[model samples]
Target chain A: MHIVVCIKQVPDSAQIRVHPVTNTIMRQGVPTIINPYDLFALEEALRLRDKMGGKVTVLTMGPPMADESLRKALGLGADAAVLLTDRFFAGSDTLATSYALAAGIRKIGEEEPVDIVFTGKQTIDGDTAQVGPGIAKRLGLNQLTYVAAIRSLDLENRSIVVERRAEGGVQVLSTGLPCLITMLEGTNTLRRGAMDDMFRASRATIATWSAQQAGVDDIALCGLRGSPTVVKKVFAPQPRKEKAKMVETAGKSDAEIAQATLDTLFSANPKLETDLRKLAAAS
Target chain B: AKKELSEHFKTYKDVWVFIEMERGKVHTVSWELLGEGRKLADKLGVQLAAVILGPPGNDLKQAISDAWSYGADLAYVVSEPLLKDYRNEPYSKALTDLVNTHKPEILLLGASTLGRDLAGSVATTLKTGLTADCTELAIDDDRCLAATRPTFGGTLLCTIFTLNFRPQMATIRPRVMAMPERRDAKPGRVIEFKLSMVEDDIVTKILDFVPDTSTEEAHLAYADIVVAGGLGMGNPGNFRLITDLAAVLGAEYGGSRPTIQKGWISADRQIGQTGKTIRPKLYIAAGISGAIQHRVGVEGADMILAINTDANAPIFEFAHYGLVGDATRILPALTKAFEARLAVRRMAS
Candidate 1:
């Protein structure tokens, strides 16, 4: 049971603030971290490897700096790391991205048959959960998204069951092995790397693969040339100019403060009380 | 049609909206998409069709009629017992089969769990581009679907074009579009299709369903009143301030994306672009900075009241009501006030 986990290094979106006057993204001084969601996938893969006695290879397609993320995954007990970076692969959308990743996974499988490919539900930057399905379609692998938990695995029979989060309920789905699974967030806590594992990770040699080396036979299908969707424009959201009406509560007692705010709330929206009363009565 | 589109795609006509249903109940987002799809159909001077795949019963017929009332000119129905519950393999195959058999120029779906799951697989299976979570959809001069969505962590908006694809497909997030007016309950042309595949063909089998029973299940999407906390809440202990206020007002409690990432709240309770898009009558955001990510989710709230110590917080710019004070103190004050007011009503009544 060999597993490949796809991870990306993204700028911490929480710290990213837009310049008020310019309405431009302020990326300076914002540190890059492995996509927070990807950690759950990486951890899930490592846990599977631990239980099944297989190797977990962490893979990423990004700039040279993305090696830092692969190294971080290695520190967390991934058996191997591969970085797919090349100038030609730049500007790839989800389609080209899935193409490159499928090629990379195929090349890895040429050495050892890959059983499961894992990725986060979606990348923070892209927020498009298309890549996993795209890759699955390209590679003809069974794809499962938003998996909350891995229930059972029978490597011999090549069967697995997972709890997938659906809209109103959870679907306990059973699928065959050699499928691609996108782990949902908050399913498990990422384990901290031990001292021995940290030392081993530092000494591990990260495999470097260019577009050609990653089994990308047609370079045209690997980057911007392959992407069908085109972005027409990129602009900041227009801000609303209306400021909120402030409720005064300066130096007032708790009871008075509550009374004043309630007064303003009821006065401004005269029907609010009626609506709440209706809801209360019905419930 | 763009000049780049091959002659093979020229024959693709009409706009189709996938009508989503579960447990014999139609999801409201499906109607929203149908409403949106009707406009694109009108713009292209083509027919607006609703595609329904479900079990064989009156539920499917009612769904088609609902779609017709929502301005659809036609309805495509594929009824089968196997299609009762949404399994990606069967649903995607059934949808892909429908698209290939009857080529529609554009396909629209609601960005619900079922829609997202089915859209990705169907689009991939058809080898076409799919834009997800679109905020806007319009037919371009060239007849391309201009799907616009917030990108780069919601800092900017990007309009994507599937220029060469036969059926330009997109999934619009719920609450982003206005529900269209229902025409005088007219019946549309119904085209019924067949599900050729059997149950054994699907590799994935549904074993059991466990409905969400956690106390933290914040029904934020449909809540009339929502109270959300942010990083300003200080810590996990202070989250009680939000829940306490919500309990008093019978409102739902949620948090910003940061609180979810920080593990202060569950992911379901997070309100933002990546989380849940909530449209409540009143949304009270405590100590929220109102980033574009969070703004997209709460902007639909009928009235937003924001409380933050920083008067310069972006939330104030959009909030219907604003206050400059520590939420730690303000939250408790508001809670006490609401409780007192409601308690008095209970006694008087």
Candidate 2:
């Protein structure tokens, strides 16, 4: 079984800050890491590969610097890594992105048949969660998204069962092999790489593919020109009129301060006190 | 004020909202989108329509009627056995067929798991643009759909427009918009469509469905009051203080993303841009630094109270009230205060 896991290199969103005066994202000092959601997908792929005796190849579409993320995936026991990078791929939206990635996957499939494809539930930067399904549609593969767990897999029968998270319930779905899955976050933890694997990752040569090398025949569908959605404008959300009103607690005990705070809250919205009483009583 | 439309997009009209239903109950986000779609349709001088796809049953009929009552001027429904449960293949094919035949200018769907799965496939098949998790939607000066969504993890908001696409599509999370007031409106027109594909064409099959039986599931999005903690809560043991305070107020409890990463709280109970968006009457955030991601999720609350030891935490910038102290101590104190106050009320009543 050849399993391909698609990952993305995204800015560490936790450390990202907006400029107070300009209202622009401060991307200069923000460090980049593998998108957190994708790690779960990669780990699940590695585990499946370990059990089923197969290969796991990490795939990413980004600038040249994304090679670091691919290397990190290799260090975590992936067999190989592919970086799909090109100047024409800049400003690609989810639709254009999935198109290029699908082309690359097709190229990979030509080398060796891919039985399964994995991606994160969503990326932190875009938070769109569209590309996974987009790739599935383009490739005509069965799409299973938001998968919480893989219950069973039969290689001879070429069937897999997964527990997919739906609204308020979990759907146990069975599908044929060569399907695409977007793994949910918090489903699995990434394993620590061995020292030898880390050393190998440092020296491994990643296969870098341009748009053409990835079998993208249509240049029109490669970048900004191919994207249908246009960003008309970007700005910061309007700040509230005033900062939080501090409850003075310098000399007061914790209990006293708590009572004072409740008094202030109730006084500000008189109906809230009665509402809270009813809610508390019911509970 | 409308701009000249291209020849390809000239015939596309009306704003469509996909009414999502599962287990015989319609998701509330469908009605919220209908409420929003009405405003956009009225602005563009077009009709508001709801698109429903499911098996033929009373549940589907109720959804159609509810769509009209909520604000849909008309509804397009496709009922077939293949659509009984939301398998991507049949649902996307049915929806895509309807969109092709009707040619809607704008399509809105909830950003739920099923909706996202269907929307992505349908939009890709149609080769159109889809913006996910849009916070705001409006008719622009040129009469295009302007979908505003948080980007770069809620630090900035970008307005996206699908100019060349005939059917502009977008998804919004549940509770992001106010629930529309249901009214006694006349039943809208229903246009029924037929699915030509059979079950054999589908590859994926549903083996079983496990409904969430745990009564303790977090209903954070629709909670009246909410209490959340962050890494500053120190450890998983201290995270219980949030639950304790919430219990006293009869509020739902959640945590920041970091807390979820640390296993202090379940992923479903995470309150941030990538988690759940909540709009409660009152939201009390404890020990959270209030990153923009977390701020956007809870900013819709009517009142926000932030408690932290750091007086300069970003949460205080927008929170309605601030308590500069350790949440470990303040949470228990607040819990006691509420408990006593409620006991006094209970005795009086």
Candidate 3:
């Protein structure tokens, strides 16, 4: 079995601070992290590789600097790394993104048929959980999203059963291999690389592909030209109209703040009283 | 101020929201977009339309009628059985074909699992710009759809401009916009057509759909009160404090994206920009640092109560109420309070 894990290099959004006065994104000195979500996917892929015995290829689409994320995946026991990078791939929306990535996965399939593909539920920056499904759609792969756990995998039958998150309850779905799985976050722990693996990762050669190399026939379908929605503008979220009405405990006992806060909350939303009641009964 | 897709946008003319349906029933979010689409259409001075793809039957007509009441001026109906269960092929093709034949000024979809899957593929096929998870949409003075969304990891918001692109597109999360009241005695126009395709013609079969199930998963989108944990919950063990409070409140629970990243909670329970956006009437955030991403996801809540150890944490800035205390201690107290209240109700009953 061959597993391909798609990873992305995202800016450390937590560390990114907008200059308090200027409002400009302070990019300088801000470090980039292998999107934390990708690690979970990579770890799941690696764990599968270890259990099932196969090579793990970590793939990404970003600038040349993205190779760092791919190498890090290699350090964590992945067998190969592929970087889908090109000017054509720049400014691609989730749609174009899926197209390029699907092509890359297709190319990897040419070398070795892939049995499974793993993606983080979504990217922190895009916050759009569309790409994984987009890739699954374009490639005609079964998409298992919001997956909690892989209950079992029967390689002989080419089937895997997984617990999927749905609107109401967990859906225990059993599907075939050669599919795409978007693992839910916090499902598993990603192991750190040992010294030997880290050294090998530092020296591993990464495969880089452009549009033609990745089997993309149309340039228009691979970038901003292909995305259907347009963002006319993005600005800071509007601030709330009123400042918080801090609950005051003044002149009362030490317990006043908590009680006062609850009072203010309930008074503001009459339904909350019923909700609290409903909540109590449910509990 | 600059248009992002200026060179190619003039060709689009109508506001189109994908009316996603399954097993003959149009999803609630479809109607939600129509309510939203009505506003955009009026702003753009265009017709508000819905692209309905489903199996041919009574369900399609009912779905189209539903769209009409939801403020859509027209319904572009493509009927086929293979399009029924939402395998990407038929739906994407049908929607793309409709877009090519009748150019639209904008497209809107619900940011659900099904919507996200189909929208991405159709947009790619049409070769146009697509924005995901838009929090707000409006027609600019130029009559262009201004798509406002969180970006750069939700650290800052970026307004994307597909300036010259036809059919500006965006997907909105559920409950972000209030559901407009439907006119019961209302009816509108629907154009019904048979999609010339079947299951055999489609390449990928609906081999199966595997579901993710966690007893703790609450599908928080519709929860009245959401109790979510954050990195401040300390170790993974401490997450139970949040769950205990949530269980006591009888609310679906989640954590900030950071908590999910920390492996303290499953991604299904993550409540943030990359996870789920909840508009519960009351949101109690425990030990979570309120970052822009987390804030954007939950700010829709009517009232937000934040409890974090750090007095200066960003969570306090926008949180409706702030309590500077250890969530470990505070959560237990809240749980006990709710538990006792619930007991009283049960005994009274």
Among these predicted structures, which one has the highest DockQ?
A: 2
Give candidate 2's fnat, 2 decimals: 0.88
lDDT of 2 by residue, A1-283 (tens): 9999999999998787778877677889789999999999999999999999989999999999999999999999999999999999999999999999999999999989999999999998988999999999999989999999999989889999999999888999999988999999878878999899899999999999999999999989988877888877778888888999999999999999999999989899988888899889888
Expressed as tens digits, the lDDT of each residue in B207-296 for candidate 1 is 988878884473677788899999999999999999999888788889998899888988788888888888888899998999888999
Best-fitting candidate, measured by TM-score?
2
Docking class for model 1 is medium
Ranking by lDDT: 2, 1, 3
lDDT string for model 1 (A1-283, tens) is 8999999888887677667766666779998999988999999999988998999999999999899999999999999999999998987877788889999999999999999999998877778888887777778777788899999999999999999998777989888878999899889999999888889888889999999999899998767777667777666787787788887868887567667878887888988877766555554
lDDT of 3 by residue, A1-283 (tens): 9999999898887787777666667878878888887788898888888998989999999999899888888888999999999999887878778889999999999999999999998877777777887888778777777777888888899888887754444566667777899887777988989889999999988998888998888888777676544544445566776545455544643244455656677778777878778766766
Question: Which DockQ values do the candidates obtain, in the order shown?
Answer: 0.57, 0.70, 0.35
Model 2 per-residue lDDT tens digits across residues B133-220: 9999999877899999998888889899999887999999988998899999999899999997999999899999998885556478
- Candidate 2 residues lying further than 4 Å off, grouped into runs, are A19-24, B1-4, B343-349
Better of 2 and 3 by lDDT: 2
The C-alpha stretches of model 1 lying farther than 4 A from their native spots are A15-30, B1-3, B181-183, B214-218, B234-241, B258-265, B332-349
lDDT of 1 at B345: 73
Kindly provide the TM-score of model 2 when superposed on the true structure, using C-alpha atoms.
0.96
Q: How close is candidate 1 to the true structure, as a TM-score?
A: 0.92
Each model's C-alpha lDDT? 0.86, 0.92, 0.78
